[model samples]
Target chain A: MTSPVVEVSHLRKTYPAAKRGGTPKTAVADVSFQVARGEIFGILGPNGAGKTTTVECLAGLRRSDGGTVRVLGQDPQADPLLIREHVGVQLQEAALHDKITVAEALDVFGSFYSERADPAELLDLLDLTAHRHQQFGKLSGGQKQRLSIALALVGKPQVAILDELTTGLDPAARRATWELVERVRDSGVTVLLVTHFMDEAERLCDRLVVIDGGRVVAEGTPSALIEGLEGDRGVRLRFADDGARERATQLLAALAERDADVTAAVPIGDEIEVTGTRKVLFAVVQELAAADVVPDDVRTLERTLEDVFVQVTGREYRVEENEEVAA
Target chain B: MTAVETTGPVRVNHEGLRFRAFWTLFGTELRVWLREPTGVFFALIFPSLLLLGLGLAVPDFSKPMADAPPPWNEAPGITSYLPTIIALAVGTISLTTMPVQFATFREKGILKRLSTTPMPPQNLIGVHMVINVLALIVSAGAAVVGGMVVLGVPFAADPLVVLLVLVLSTTAMFSLGLLVAARAEKGQTASGLGMLIYFPSLMFSGVWVPLSVMPDWMQEIGLYLPLGAAAQGLTMGWFGNEGFPLAQVLVLAVWTLVLFPLGVKLFRWT
Candidate 1:
């Protein structure tokens, strides 16, 4: 059997507590997973979920207290030098010296590898050719992120790891970055992406592992997880007036009685959202038709990955911690 | 062009990884130092100013005894002060610049980023040391020239002795700076603590006052300090004096040998 591009087993990391702390913090605990060659494997989690810690261990930046991590079939801890040749890493807060020009930084990083991709080509790929002579500090936030990806690709690594690739990007730039990631994967490099954004995972990841409280909570394709939660599907109905809303509410109540699985009827804005399984949803629609309670808009939508996450983990998709969002 | 072979023939190599890593870090240090005029001014100009200011302000006591002879009469006072000024300057740059640079690099996540690469931590420190040593030599030369021009100080005819003294003194100061830089948690703390060491060394090593005039016990204690030994060696070299104390050389050497490895061991990349 062919070996996986990346393999981790029983990885653990614990840090000593600070003064006035109750107990030591376990950043990661016995986490294990494997990524097939040329596939985009994502790590999805909330803040403080140990996603970054796990990736750091895989990158050989932080030493794990226990367990084995192998990248490209070489031990990251024992053979970090060998592993680095095949793996490119773009850390969340990593940056170059402010005064260093983009081209110079690329050249300098390129020199670290025995075989390197053409700097000009990389710059063009990341849409940074125009900023080749500009200083690193002078670049915009999106430009800097792109330049970082260029640096990582310079080595022509077989495996690339990206942490928070598009956390602060606007929608347009985020879409561009997603396309860039797909291009990177198409070049035959396996990708290990770490992000908290469920939309990003659903759009880009072939498969993903959800981490919470320093352990794996779930692992599967985005479609599979959403499919698993389809039984709890819901329909949102919008009405033109309060009278229409009242009529829809009475119709939903009757539908709930007919279908035992119709768990809740929620009122949102000028609409009443009905939630239940496929069978329950069908019964609700039939009952509404029988009552002639035709609403302004009625749409059936399956549970998204976000909804599945909320149901299983009992937490919403928290894109920002309070401190980070304030900053 | 011959079909630019881009397939299996193209393989990542690690043959020159060590050299490449070292040079990249070394270039980074030099580039940053060159770009910052304030840093260059303090590292180079401050020592020159201290040497000229103190040498001219103080009396020339190289003449024969008026009151049982000034203790520094055996050597030209300016010459004695010159080495201490150089040592202090070397210490200032290494301790002040290195730790601050390291701390800022850590705070900026540059060190953490570099750690993900194939480069070892030793290469990072080695590059910093190399760049610092080069800067130290350049600053020390300027100080010597400044002393000669401003204070009319004479050079030792024995080039070998001068070189030896500079080497030993630089080694000692560099080790001390490394120790401070490695231990300090923050840039401000490193700079403040380094200055704490710098002021005392300047006072006790006879950079500001003649060590010979100090009490006999004070002189004995100063002999053990690397800065004092360096100052004395430079004095002996510049005046072309014989009977330069071997103990001073030994003391500086011992400090270099002991502190350097300890500094490296304690150093934090992040």
Candidate 2:
């Protein structure tokens, strides 16, 4: 087997308490993955899900308390000076000097490497030519994001680690950046991207690992992962009265028995939910009508990656507003 | 990937890489500060402006004191203010400007951005140090020449000793500034600390009262502080009356020794 360009095994990191004597919180726990050469790999997670910490450890920005990580076949922390020159990193919330112009920022960063790409080419590629002399503080949100990407690519690094790569970009700009990433990959640079955007992961990633509560909940190609989410879509039905509700419940049970695809028929409060394949909903509505029950409200929930996330992690994918762990 | 230079026992272009990296960042830093004319105002212009303002307001300041007292014998009133003006150059650049700029860069992640590459981010701090040193030199030179032509204060009676005192005093003050930059995590904290240090150090440089005229208790305290020692050293150099202010110079040297390492150790790139 060919060696992976990046490999992380049994990784763990914990942050000290925010207060003087509070208990420490683990930011990453037992995370493991490997990135093959030339692949556009991804770490997909909600805010504060240890995605950033995992990559920060890879970039040697944060030292992992346990486990091992090798990037381009060397330890990033033990040999940061050697590793730094070969890897390009775009930090999640990092900023440039407010007064520094875009062109000057590019020039200074480009000089840090022995072999660097022509910055003018990168400027044209990222569509930052017009704003070359504009101060970083004056650029629009998308412009700032593009300039940041430009700086990351300026060194012509072997692997690029981009964290939250498209947070502030407009939809069109986000798509454009995705295409740019594809081009970077085509030229044979391994990209390790961290993002919460499902469409971005599906559209760009060759393979990805889903992180939740500082652990790897799922990992695979986007389609395979979604398919492995038990391929569930739910049909929620509410009846007008208790008689109709009970009738509907029996009918769902009867239908689930006859159909091989109906995975579950469960009562959630005053409603009934039938979960299975796409055919389950059609079979369910037909059986309900045949039983002479009229439903007051009915809704269909299709399984996307977002749903897959909930299924695997057992929680909604939203910002962890109360994470004691810090930035 | 070919973009990554493969590992080998021998490294090539080490010198070329060093020179290129240094000049690129160093020159860019110089240009960035050049855009900010306010640095000139604070470092060079402030000292002379303060002197010109004070010289005009006080009539007897321009006239040398008659039958000067033992310690004040070498220092007339206006002559004392000239060295304090030079000390002002050292104080503002070191305490106010250096710490603020250093902390702002770290707060903004400018230093973090640079750290991802082969270049060490703290070299950015070195660039700032170089520029501030140059500013101190220019301002000190301007104060000495301006005192001679504008205020009729005599030139340094011992030029070599004056330069040596300026170097030692600047090292002392900037080391203190470095310590503040190392510990301060935010721009607000850096500025607050800078101002806290700047005002007291300015006073101790003895701009308002010649140390010889100050109460015994105050002089006793001021002599131990870097700025106070600097004030006395510069005045002694101006009078041509010193071998070296050994006690005062030692005080300044000790401060540089203690603070510079602590600052470098405490500084966080991010």
Number of clashing pairs per prediction, in order: 0, 0
Instruction: Evaluate residue B248 in candidate 2 and report its C-alpha lDDT on the 0 to 100 scale.
Output: 79
Model 2 stretches astray by more than 4 angstroms: A234-275, A281-301, A321-324, B1-13, B68-77
Which residue pairs clash within candidate 1?
none
TM, every model: 0.87, 0.87
DockQ of each: 0.29, 0.40
Clashes of 1: 0
Docking class of 2: acceptable
lDDT of 1 at B80: 56
lDDT of 2 by residue, B21-86 (tens): 888888888777777778668877888888876776688776676666545454446776787788
| lDDT agreement with native, every candidate | 0.76, 0.82
- Please give the range of 10 consecutive residues that has the lowest summed lDDT in model 1 chain B: B1-10
* Candidate 1, B1-270: lDDT as tens digits: 122112321334555766766787678657866877777777767888877777777676333333333343443556656667766776667666666666666566676677666665566666777777777777888888987776765666556766787788778777787788775556687778777787778776775667556677766777788777776666566556455657888998998998888977887776
Q: What is the model-wide C-alpha lDDT for candidate 1?
A: 0.76
